[model samples]
Target: MTTQAEKSQQALILFAHGARDPRWAEPLQRLQQIVSKQVSGDVLVHQAFLELMTPSLPELIAHLVQQQVAAVTVVPIFLGQGGHVRRDLPELITQLSADYPQVRFTLAPAIGEDEQVLKAIADVCIAQL
Candidate 1:
């Protein structure tokens, strides 16, 4: 069970590889907003990009730590366990966690290869069919 120490002022850090087209950020931002509203105990949400964004994951995590957040969950908003998710994110998380030991950090699995994702793709393909 996730205790309040792990729950209080919890932040969900959504990391996405940004798009040159600014509009691409919208859907993830919308999803973040929805989840932020639903989670219990003053859930805070932030978005960090692998590139083309002001705050990277390390920077965002540091900012959340400065806010004295009790805990945070880093969820990669990538489509799959691609190169960035497989390599960069883990290294970044490790470095940030080392720098800030007080704040607890949880790294969730990437939203890749899930049934829901497959269904979504199937639905899109079905439309073409």
Candidate 2:
């Protein structure tokens, strides 16, 4: 059985590879807004950058810890499972797990790799054509 506090202590982090131009994050921000609205109750939906953007993963995790979030689901927005997703992210999650032993860290596959997402992209392309 989960307590109310425990129920409120879950978060979802949308992780993305940041770019030098802030405009690059606009789509991600919109995605965040969409996800945020879909989530009910106290569940948090946040976006963090791997580089060249504010509030990196570690920083966001620290803040979430402060907010007493007990679990985090990290969803990579990258199109492929490249070095950043396959290597660097796991290393970072391992370190964060060590640092915050109480918190459960879950790494989700890259959004673009999902069949539904791919279908959506194709649908858009088809519509444009």
Top candidate, metric lDDT: 2
lDDT of residue 49 for candidate 2: 91
Local lDDT at 10 for model 2: 86
lDDT of 2 by residue, 38-106 (tens): 997678999999999988999999999987899999999998899999999999999999999989999
Clash count in backbone of candidate 1: 0
TM-score of 1: 0.83
**Candidate 2 displacement at residue 18 in angstroms:** 0.4
TM-scores of the candidates in the order shown: 0.83, 0.92
In terms of TM-score, the best-performing candidate is 2
Which pairs clash (backbone N, Cα, C closer than 3 Å) in model 1?
none
Local distance difference test, each candidate: 0.82, 0.93
Deviation of model 2 at 5, angstroms: 8.0
RMSD of each: 3.9, 2.4
